[model samples]
Target: MKTDSRWITTPITADLLRGALDLERTEHGVLPHRLPARARAQCGDPQLAMVESQPSGVRLVFRTRATAVELDTLPTKRLYVGAPARPDGVYDLLVDGTLAGQGSVSGGTVQVVDMSTGSMELRPGPVGTLRFTGLPGRDKTVEIWLPHNETTELAELRTDAPLTVAPDPGRKVWLHHGSSISHGSDAASPTAIWPALAAALAGVELVNLGLGGSALLDPFTARAVRDTPADLISLKLGINVVNADLMRLRAFGPAVHGFLDTVREGHPTTPLLVVSPILCPMHEDTPGPTAMDLSALGAGRITFVATGDPAERASGKLTLNVVRDELSRIVAQRAAEDPHLHYLDGRALYGEADAAELPLPDGLHPDAATHRRIGERFAELAFADDGAFAGSGGERRAGGR
Candidate 1:
């Protein structure tokens, strides 16, 4: 039996973990991975902070095939823990309720923070270890919850508890990558991130690798996606690469081809959706800005500017439109030969229609409501039952960088 097989066994009981907090019943003494907030509330655990916003112990939890697990397999599954409500610059992680992984952050760091319990501390943000564990037998579903943000998890149940469920197994898996916008920008809750929301609406499993500022088409990233196990996949490209003005046309074109080529190498016929960036008026046609400018918002500090006229948007000179055009053209050409390959224009996902009414809060990244709308549109277009993508696993599972 492979370590990370998608044959998940859930309806897991709280007795699986011996932690401080007692888990409330998920369908009574069991919790599945797709525990929605409402379900969590009903189960009494809430599953809220357990995802991202919650502290170290429960930020996120996953079932592992590790008996005495050695970390990593295939594409690598890493946990990204962010700074918590109280920044200690250090935090500890307990796997199966024992101190395991650890990293630390500096005090008062603005963008990201860290947490510490015992000697272990977790990484602040954007990056962290890609981990794997082995929990053998029909038992699946590990528990996660931070001590401070601690809510009850199924693991807190009594030992020798009854197996809540065996397996039904119909859910598909989703693979996605993008920028900070996709990572979860202004969303109020961690679970409310567009991808999370989309996953809920679609009823599929998800593996999200949306690095905030790091979706630069690195070969490593492409390789990561290619080798991982997924029923369906999508890449929300262009925006961040353009906003950062990170690469030029000469390199961008080849990068897109190479990125797809790498993935096709592994999952050649798997449903692959390559989506271009959504609209951003400022840098749509303009080369994005090089130096940070803050006068627009009238703020003192100058951060990266995402919008401006085509010529003046950036000194380094890459625009959102240029990247999106290049990306779409590449995907379209590929689709001609590969029936499984598909292209979704970002605008089709979220376009001028939306911009007219729901302007982006900061001229970049959508607010929560916009995220919902984008999710809805994506679900409508990509998973329209009769669409080419009906088999593509499109249940509002797309957002931008």
Candidate 2:
């Protein structure tokens, strides 16, 4: 019955949400005034796609019917939005027509925390719209974050500020792929996601394809990478495929080539880096498809754990070493003809030594702090030379450090 309690949808989609723009209405459906090439083809699931970047002005518009009363003080109960960059994450609250609020966002120092501590608190990230929770009676100014994906940028305006957001100008587009860790499982903020932080450090942009619970070398994802535009690209592989038992030695070889082949079509010759998995004890050396960890979620707990044998991991069945070895072979053979391809031992960024100090907080994803460390290492290794990859080979990549 109320604006906040209801929402309307139109048929419009794009690859990756990019740039800033105004919303437009079309006979076919609602369309964004402008969409970047890369963002034009992301997230095949249109069910939850944003109308545009920030919903193409109103991508995920939500409001509340709660009568206005001035916020005598900060509200206690709050909302949380995790994986802000992920398309399926549709958890934004808008007030009036402007973006009055946002989900919890993290900066370089702060971690996104929800009132529950384990969750992220959704609140105003930028100030294009105004959210009226209990503020109907007062003539007061409420603070709002800029409507667009803003970080390291700042400005201030009253609720009357025109609803125009400057597109992210520090765009350095880094395309990253990996397991849950890369999907931002434990990172502190939406923007603080490792790829994002690394991009920030290098003054580049990002196109993160880190799929949670599903980075098992899906061909569609490979095509996604092939079609997307990126200044830099990195694929953090291994753990997921090994744990998922997605492929065996015979099939894995060709699959890797196919994935690369698809990417090469679009990238042609970008700074492509292949990264192996970090340390995980359970599946380290085991050949899976393993089980899930569903102990705490009511009845579904037991089914989550993988049933694969641990011996396989300890012996030859499963191991980061095996994955790394084969992966190296793949890259080596590929590099013979292509000079731009590079490889980095996942550990070097956060190898065994660092892992010892920073054990996996969740047995998989790194903690917020580790994400920061990883981001820095990636920047150093990625940009340490003349824009080339800083790998164990000690060879400078085509791009400068």
Candidate 3:
């Protein structure tokens, strides 16, 4: 590609970012984080640490007449030591709210994990550039949705024309937190994640806090939600808790209460939706500490199995079914005092029949097709004309201060 002498390079700063909670300056450039530093410091869980920095819903928003743009990034890609290979994460470019192009960058550092051995190793690599050309000639708003699954470090940004911060979409912002299912673990790209898809369909802004393996009803996470501005909120609970066996039925209800109470402090009347876990037969009735199916991994495939016994449920161990029932009951009890609060069975988004049609490929996360299905189903059930979250778009506010 030929560079024009008039091309300009702009420093990528927070002013040009959206949907991110924090940005950390680095030697290479800047790294986006879904969790702020204070909230991140409150947790020591490695899984939480990793996912919060992955930027699941973060993007760069700006306006320019540039017909060509380039972003230098160093992506930290993950690789399971014994599992099959995965492709590079994709970068999606949207012009005037429409997807104009998509591409992926390679040659990034690799974080290799050997689940069998419970060990991790880092392999350093070089940075790569992602380039998009043929953008419209006139100035237009642009959104560069980051990869949902990769940890990316933005090094620099270049364009053929001067750039300025784009105005906000002037829509309601929906803040959602969930497990890997909502993190686009299996989705094709960042914008394809269920929350992103649902937000776009409902014509609202999104602040996805869908940390993979980390939506454990933590107080700090609750506080983060409380501080953030949102017109609507949703919590997709149960899967991570059940799989990790983090808490039993004895403590689950109170945790849920505490989480909701904190958020209510910030947005008492926001349309809050409590969503239970989607269908996962492995942990449906059986308790879990979901274990990797090593036999499957050895065959160049990956799968999971519930390791907890059904008998444990009688001991107050929480299974998906138990959690779902509890969540429904809790919502009903609270709705008496807070009519704005509502509940939706995760199964409604991906129930038994839907699972039968598109079985979970890994017996855990939904596949790409299922991501699309869930996104569409969620939009229909929650954002439709008569839905619980109907008319929930954040009231339009004046653009710019």
Candidate 4:
């Protein structure tokens, strides 16, 4: 057997990972989780369990002079039967704080779930390798951001030279929570997720708690955010609640209050931003327990349609318009006493005009281009001078001006 004598392999451990709250060592490798063990134990929903384990803002960071790097991963890919196949998850390689390369590993196991029948099937596949060669010859910091939509198990890291853990950049950490939009739905790559993009634009570290179909105002999630250390915090509320039909007006207002209260208990003076949902034409005036359009699915496309009646709003059902109004009022009332608490109408990021030009392809989540637009807009609105989170110990450029 021909053996390469110059390769050095390092076991991926918690020390090499950032933006992850916990790591679970598995038989094959280490799995990074966004939620701590205690918080994970409090939830019994399988959906939540799955999503919390999907690394959204997690990255493997180290310093090396290696010209070649290889990462072995075992990823659990999801597939929905009778629907369009999803794209392969992408891994982004950043060298010296610049995006240097992008790659994807194939051959991971697939979990096919039939949403109509509620049955799932597991199809085992081989592990795959992601390799990037011809990096700069000098010592430099390297960050490998994992896929946001897939559950990745990091098995081994191999390089041509010795590696050391990268020193923290001392940037302010921004912890954010939202639904699938924040979870990178339709995003092109791991770093393209809106929160990641916004974090880059804002020059802050991101800790994203964006669970798909699972942001139900759960106490554990609020507690998770409460316990995490952060210089800036933002919560994108309302869309998930409205779409999931998780609660009525009566419970939503109080639940929001409780969530904020819990966060405030841990961070009384921290800069906290509360954002409502963007304009979703389907659910703007109508309440929803959003359902799939079967006809569209049969036509080889997927579409979501609001099922609840608009008249239900009169009986206290929640809608996007209702949620936005209520959220604005709540933040305004509290901001008088809490100077650091701030609010941004989500429409400022994406409104009816933007929707007309660039519609949500699925009638819910924004596409990749929209993600870019939102990220850029957020940086301007929330991270600029005199903005809600501006100069709150976050990174700034030049001249103290």
Best prediction by lDDT:
3
Error of 4 at 101 (Å): 0.7
**Tens digit per residue, CA lDDT, model 2, 1-401:** 11332322212222112322233443323333223334445545321132222211112211223333111111111222232222122123334423344443332112243322344433433212223344343232222222222221111112211122323343355667776667666565554557656866776545556655556666667776776556678898887777667666767778788889988998877878998877665555556765534343333222233457656544445456778888889999999998889888777778777788887764566877888888888888877865455332322222111
Model 3, clash count? 1
Give the residue spans of candidate 1 off by over 4 A: 1-169, 290-292, 295-309, 312-316, 392-401
- For model 2 the local lDDT of residue 7 reads 29
Please report how far candidate 3 places residue 296 from its true position, in Å. Answer: 0.8
Q: Ranking under lDDT, best-scoring first?
A: 3, 4, 1, 2
Question: Please, what is the TM-score per model?
Answer: 0.59, 0.60, 0.97, 0.96
Per-residue C-alpha lDDT of model 1 across residues 1-401, encoded as one tens digit per residue: 12344333343333333211223343223322222233334432211223322221123344443333221101111221232243222233445434454433222112222112212233322212222334344444433322221121222211122233213234676667776656655554444567656765776655565555556786766776776667778898877676566777878899889999998998888788888878877667767543334353234322345444565534435687667767778877888899888888888867898899988776777878887877677667666786435756433322110
Q: Candidate 4's residue-wise lDDT over 1-401, tens digit each? A: 11367889987877788879889988778999998899888988777877888898899999999999999898889997778888888999999889999998898889897777778788988778999998999999999999999899888899999999887777778889898898888899989999999999888888898888877788888888888888888999999898889899999999999999999888788899999988899999999899877778777777899999999999899999999999999999999999999999999999999999999998998999999999998999999898999777634322110
Question: Candidate 4 — which residues are off by over 4 angstroms?
Answer: 1-3, 393-401
* Model 3 regions lying over 4 Å from their true place: 1-4, 393-401
Q: What is the C-alpha RMSD of each candidate to the true structure, in Å?
A: 13.8, 11.5, 1.9, 3.2
- Expressed as tens digits, the lDDT of each residue in 1-401 for candidate 3 is 22567668788888888878888998789999988899989888878888998988889999999999999999999999778778999999999999999999999899998989988888999989999999999989989999999999999888988899987667777889999989888898889998999989988788899999888999999998888878888999989999899999989999999999999998899999999999999999999899889999898888999999999999999899999999999999999999899999999999999989999999999988999999999999999788878875545533211
Worst 10 residues of 2 by lDDT: 69-78
Worst lDDT run of 10 residues, candidate 1, spans 71-80
Residue 269 accuracy (lDDT) in model 4: 84
Point out where model 2 deviates above 4 Å. 1-159, 165-171, 294-307, 310-318, 386-401
Give candidate 1's whole-model lDDT: 0.52
Cα miss at 161, model 4 (Å)? 0.4
**Alpha-carbon local distance difference test for all models:** 0.52, 0.51, 0.90, 0.88
